[model samples]
Target: MRVAIIHDELMRRGGAEQVVLTMLKAFPDADIYTIAYNSEGTYPEYKEYKEKINTSSFQIFSKSIKLMQKFYFPWGIIAMKAVKVTDYDIVIISNTHCAKYVNIDSKALVFIYTYTPFRLAWNPSSYSQYNNAKGVFKWIFDKVISCLKYIDFKAALRGDYFLAMTEETAQRIKDAYKVDDIKIIQPDVKTRNFYVSKQPGDYYLVVSRLEHYKKVDLAIEAFNELGLKLIVVGNGTKAAELKAMAKNNIEFKSGLSSKELADLYANCKAFVFPQHEDYGITPLEANASGRPVIAYGKGGVLETMIPYDVHESKCTAVFFNDQTAESLINAVKTAEHLIFDPAFIRKHAELFDENVFIKQFKSFVEEKYEEHSSSVIKSH
Candidate 1:
C-alpha cells in the first residue's frame, strides 16, 4: 500500500519525533507530510530522509512555531485541508493538536497516533505562562484558546481510528473527544544503545525539554537542597528561567550525541524525571542503562517504572507522590536505600524495546487495513 505519514510539526527531536522515526522504519517507502520541518532543528539522522518529507507552507515559520502555534492551528487546518494526500491508500496522522484535520481520500484509512488531546486545550492550567495573564488579557487569551479547542475537537472527529500512547493518554482522549474506541501503544527506546554499567559515578541525570510542565525547576530545587551533582540536559523556552533558578551543583547541558547521552545515563547514580508525561521513554532508557529513576509518582512512569521499596529488591525507580522539592528529596532518599540490580533493571526495560514496538504497530495497522478492505468489498 502507498502510505503517507502526517504529523503536526517537526520542530524538535522528542518522543513524538521518535514515534515518527519508528513508523518510517516500519513503512520504509511511506512519504511524510507535516505542517513544518527544520532539518537541523531535530535529530541529525532525520536529514537522511529529507527526500521523502513534504512540508506545508508553514515550513517558513518552523523555527518559531513554539511562539506562533496559537495562530498556526486555525490557519494550519485550512492549509492542510487544501494540500491533498488522496493518492495514498493509507494516511496515518501522528498528532497532538491540528494535523488530524488533514484532508485525505474518503476511502483511505486514516489512523491517528494521539500523544494527548492538545494539552493547552484540555488542561490550560498546567501552563503557568498562559495563566499568568490577568484581567482583559487573560479574558482574551481564554476566549481564543476556547475557540481553538472547538476547532481541534472537530478535527479529532476526522480520524478513522485513534491510537493512544498509553492508558493514561487513552483516558485523556476519551475525556476530551468523547471517543470510546482507542488503542494504547507505548513508544519504545533503542535498548542496544544502552547497557548495564558496573560502576556508577556521583551524579543524577535528567534529559528533558525545559518546559514549564516538565517541572525541571523542582528537580533543580531538590538537588540544590541536597547539594548533589545533577546534570540537566535538553533545551526549550523555559531553559533560561530554569538555569537562573538552579544552584551551582545543577549543571545544564544541551545537544549531546546519542553515545554521549548513553554514557551519562550509564554513569549517573539515578535518572531524575519530574514531569507527569503522557508516556515517558527517558526512564525506560535509563533502566536500559541499568540506572534507577527518581520520578513523580503519577502518569506514564507508573506503567513503566517499578517503584522502589525496602522489601522489593527488583524495583527500578522511587516515586514522589507530590510535585514538590521536598517530595523529590524524600524519594531520592528512598532510592538511596533500595537495592537495584543492574542486570535486572536492564531486563525490565527490554519489554519496551524498539523491536517490540515495530512489530506490534505493524500488526495493528495491517489488521485494520484488512478489516477495512473486507467491509468495503461487502458494501458493493
Candidate 2:
C-alpha cells in the first residue's frame, strides 16, 4: 500500500518528529508531507527515504499557521489545503492542531498524535506570540482562524479512522468530534537515554518547552525551599522572565548534546518535572538515566510514570498530587529521603525503549492496514 505521512512542521527535533521517523522506518517508501522543515542533524535516518511534498505557495503568506495554531484553527486549513493529497491511498497525520488538513482518500487512515490540542492550542498564556493584532489584519486573521478550525473539524468526518496518542486525547477526540472508534497509541521513548548509569549528579534537571503552563516558576519555588541545586533546560519567550525570577538554587542552561545531557541525568539527585504532561518524554528520560522523576500528578503522569511510594526501599520517583509549591517541596523531600538502585531504575525505564516502541508500532499499523482494507471491501 502506498502511504503518505502528513505533519505540521519539522523545525525541531522533538517527540512528534521521533514518532514520524519510527513510522518512516516501518514504511520506508511512504512519502512525507509537511509545511516546513529544518533538517540539521535531527533526522539523518529519514534523509534516504524522505521526500517533501511542497505547499509553499499557501505557506508563504500564511506562515502564521503555526504561530496562531490554537487561536486560529485556519492555519491548519491554510497549510493543509496547500497539499495535493488525492494521490496517496493511505494518509496518516501526526497532528496536534493540523490533523484535520490532509486530503481525503476513500481508504485514507489518519492516526493523530493529539497531545490535548484543545487545551494546548487555545490557552493564551500557554502560547504567546499569536496574531494578537488589531484593525483589518487582526479581524481578518481571527475570521480566518475561526473558519479554518470549523473546516478542519468537518474535514475529519472524511477520515476513515482516528488514532490518538493517549487515552486522554482519545476521549477528547470522542467528546469534541463525536469520534467513536478511536485507537490509542502511547508515545515512544528514546532508548539511547538508558545507556548511562546514575550516580546522583550535582544539579536537579528539568527539560521541556518553556511554556507558561509548564509552571517552571513553581519548580523555582520548590527548589528555593530545599536549597538544592537546580538546572533548567529548554527555550521559549518566558526564558528571560523565568531567569529573572529564579532563586539562588536555580541555573539556566540550554543546547546540550544527548550524551552530555544523559551524563547529567545519570548524576542528578532527582528529576523535578513540575508540570502535568501529555505523554512527556523527559520523565522517561529521567527513568532511563536511572534518575527518579518527581512529577506533578495528573494528566499523562498517571499513565506513563510509576510513582515511588515514600516508604519504598528502592524508590524510583515521587509525585506531588497538587500543582503547588508545598506539594512539589514535599515530593522533592521524599525523593531526597529514598535510596535508589541505579540499575533497577534504568531497567524500569527500558520498558518504554524506542526499539520496543518501533516493533509494537509497526505491528499495530500493519494490522490496522489489513483490517481497514477488509472493511473497505466489505462496505462495497
**Residue 245 displacement (Å), model 2:** 0.8
Tens digits of per-residue lDDT for model 2 on 1-380? 78777776665656777788777766777777776554542445545654554443344433342363443344545656666666666777776656456555564665655555544333333444443556886666556556645665776676666777678777777776677887776777776745555246678888866767788889988787878899998776578888888887898877777777777777788888888667777888888887788998877767777778654546566888989999998888877767877677777778877777667767877787788889879999
Model 2: worst 10 consecutive residues (lDDT sum) = 120-129
Misplaced by over 4 Å in model 2 are 40-76, 118-149, 310-315, 375-380
The residue-by-residue lDDT of candidate 1 on 285-361, one tens digit each, is 99999999899989999899888756456888888999999999998887776677888889999999988899988
Which candidate comes out best when scored by TM-score?
Answer: 1
User: Against the unseen true structure, what C-alpha lDDT does each candidate score?
Assistant: 0.86, 0.70
User: In model 2, what is the error at residue 264, expressed in angstroms?
Assistant: 2.1
